[model samples]
Target: MKISLKTIIAGGALAAIAALAIAAPAADNWENHCAKCHGADGKGQTKAGKKLNVKDYTDAKVQSEFSDADIVKATTSGISDKAGKEKMKAYKDELSEAEIKEMAGYIRKFKK
Candidate 1:
């Protein structure tokens, strides 16, 4: 059996496309989904962030408060206030499990 060069190149291209479809870069995802509230610097200083009283990711004390699992759960299930009003929308529908995990790691990088 012989595989043509064209077939090999096509296969590689398809694999790359599939990988991209599976997981986007964490920074891009953050900017698209979380930055409006979390801020690009992760300080939670945006207008929305201020209104919602979002935590400052740059705070070392804040970073120490949550585990990676906590991050994943909050992201997967979303957050609500004590009154049951939704604060953050769930991303489980938009992101894969792997992507969610990556987001947790990305959030950790915000610690200052």
Candidate 2:
């Protein structure tokens, strides 16, 4: 079988587009996965957020309390209350490590 240069280039472009689609942007992930509780502005002001008593990512003090690793761990493993009640659902199965790291960095940008 012979593949033309144009064909190969087109195939490569399609592959790249597929990869991009598979790996959603951090903001999109945050909006889809976190905005319900964290709010789109990271202020934790949504109704669900208020009910859950979620922290405000826009607060520098709140941001200072956690490290990037902490964010990764929370996102990958999820958070729970002291009684072992689940708070956040784990995303390790849904998100790649790279995506999780990207999310952590994205969260950092919310600090005021």
**The best candidate in terms of lDDT:** 2
Candidate 1, which segments miss by more than 4 Å at Cα? Answer: 1-11
lDDT of 2 at 59: 96
Clashing pairs in 2: none
Candidate 2 C-alpha error for residue 90, in Å: 0.6
Against the hidden reference, what TM-scores do the models get? 0.85, 0.86
Could you tell me the TM-score of candidate 1? 0.85
Runs off by more than 4 Å, candidate 2 = 1-13
Residue-level lDDT tens digits of model 1 in 47-108: 99999999999899999999999999999999998999999999999998988999999999
Instruction: Please give the range of 10 consecutive residues that has the lowest summed lDDT in model 2.
Output: 16-25
Q: How well does candidate 1 match the true structure, expressed as C-alpha RMSD?
A: 2.3
